[model samples]
Target: MTNRYRSVFDIIGPIMIGPSSSHTAGAVAIGHVANRLFHAPIKEVVVRYFESFAQTHRGHGTDYAIISGVLGFDPADRRVPLAVDLARRQGLKITFIEDQGLSPIGHPNTAAVTLINAEKEITVWGCSVGGGTIEIRKVDLNGLIFTPQGPLPILFVEANQPIGAALDQLFGENYRRPRVTHQLADHYIYQLDLLDRPFPEQIDQARGMSQDLTLL
Candidate 1:
């Protein structure tokens, strides 16, 4: 029930250099998505692969896929093969773990990704739903089930007075409304569905955007 509708990318799969959609494309997207949750530059990352991904990740280019994504490469990029070396050059330290635990969601392709910066840390639990589609099940240990439809801007921030005032001033436009919002601990997570277009520059730089927000 996370995704109510399907986008074109769901059926055709993403344009990716893939050994498989679940292993390669999905892993990269997972890492990219995990990175998006952090406001600071990623310094270290830890990923745990489950089931099939845990067994064949290395041979299937899954490791490269994640590293490339953490470095902000999309699935279709040709530089995916060099992501590991590139990460080291960028001062990103990555750790991989193999976990055999059963998934509550019953998906074969699943990962628990933890990303860290100088001050903040974020963890995401997700699964690949085939054809490059993914489901984010949790964030910061709180259930946050959803599936992205397009190139939407996801915002994560603390739900406080300043954040509210800042967001009100920023999203006061006539056409914009949050597609969904979730409260997690002291923070709030939401996604701005752009409906097949790029995000506007104005809202991207809105007054409160940087106060306590992470725009994915």
Candidate 2:
């Protein structure tokens, strides 16, 4: 597992504008990362809640919190409370699905968010373990796990051809570790956890080498 908790405050909790860190703040963090993975203007969103989240999402303001993050608002942003209205004004459609039986063996506070636009669609599965901490379990049906550390550069690459050598040259020195997941055939998902932000030129170069790529 990737350790992101840098200080006592991270373990304690995040400073956020919500009642419960797990239900609200963590949901926001999950949505935020999902947005980054999508990396495009969102036309619609479908958020599926499971177990504990399915039971009390509305009362705990999890709906608003997740939508707020999808709109690119941070957990501490004041706009969280008005996410629904803001999304409406921005012409973004949202749909919520609650399923208690979807993943009985999975974490209690789990959510699967699907982001869609005209050209592409992406799905992210996340779990809130508590104290505003979250783990991204899967992306686009591939099992790739990692925690979203604040301001840490994360890169997602999908390609039909092998690009391991390119990746090694691009991130071997600066990244802590790289998680690669095989999709169908020769396709792959390269999830790179970087120590620092890469240059814009490097990002552009990566974009040229893959079928799809996103950075966060």
Candidate 3:
């Protein structure tokens, strides 16, 4: 089950820092993605750790990693605990649980996370592989895996319409300052009107749809 063109890096790389890559790095990635998918300030979060993550998570700072991620901090930062404190000080309610039965399929460090905000709730299931690399296995309690990171259909127009020098030719004038926000991936979450456009030409839309992007 390996693709020839997929680099070793694809299998083995995710930049992060931690007590343990699986517990710390993976947990952080999960929290970060959940926060983004929700696309709003998370007022409350509950993380349920499983298997190895539950057993050795505390020693590896999994709790702090998840809390920091919910607060928008990267997993590579040494100040993850500080971020947790900052969230608490900012009145974010974060809770943790250790549950072993969530992932009967695979992955030893699986976790189910539920996030709450003023108007919505999001649940994500994820697993942390070694070396801080993480895969967001599912979202919205769907059981189907979906990862928010990387490219997908929601990004087609932005990819085709590059915001900088490329767009200068089409807009009828040279613009020194780039119109950046509209082109950023995160911005689209706030602009739902733009979601239906076809994806970039180079992307294999069918393949992207076939496999659940869940599980890094």
Q: What C-alpha lDDT values do all the predictions have?
A: 0.68, 0.79, 0.57
- For model 2, the superposed segments whose C-alpha errors exceed 4 Å read 1-6, 102-105, 141-154, 158-162, 169-178, 181-189, 193-216
Candidate 3 segments whose C-alpha is farther than 4 A from its true place: 3-15, 102-105, 141-216
The digit string of per-residue lDDT tens for model 1 on 50-72 reads: 88778888898988888887788
Number of the top-ranking candidate, with lDDT as the measure = 2
Error of 1 at 189 (Å): 5.8
Candidate 1 deviant stretches above 4 angstroms: 1-5, 141-216
Scored by Cα lDDT, where does model 1 land? 0.68
Selected candidate, larger TM-score, 1 vs 3:
1
Model 3 TM: 0.62
* Separate clash counts for every candidate: 0, 0, 1
| Candidate 3 residue 87 C-alpha distance from true site, Å | 1.3
Worst 10 residues of 3 by lDDT: 187-196
Report the lDDT tens digits of candidate 3 across residue range 18-43: 56777887678778767766667778
Residue-level lDDT of model 2, residues 1-216, one tens digit each, is: 656554587686588997889999989988998888877898999999999999999999999989988888988998898998899789999999998586532689989888888888877878887888776666663233434333235677889988878888976687765456555666877777667568888888889999998785
When summed lDDT is taken over every stretch of 10 residues in candidate 2, the lowest stretch is: 142-151
User: Against the correct fold, how does model 1 do in TM-score?
Assistant: 0.71
Poorest stretch of ten by lDDT in candidate 1: 146-155
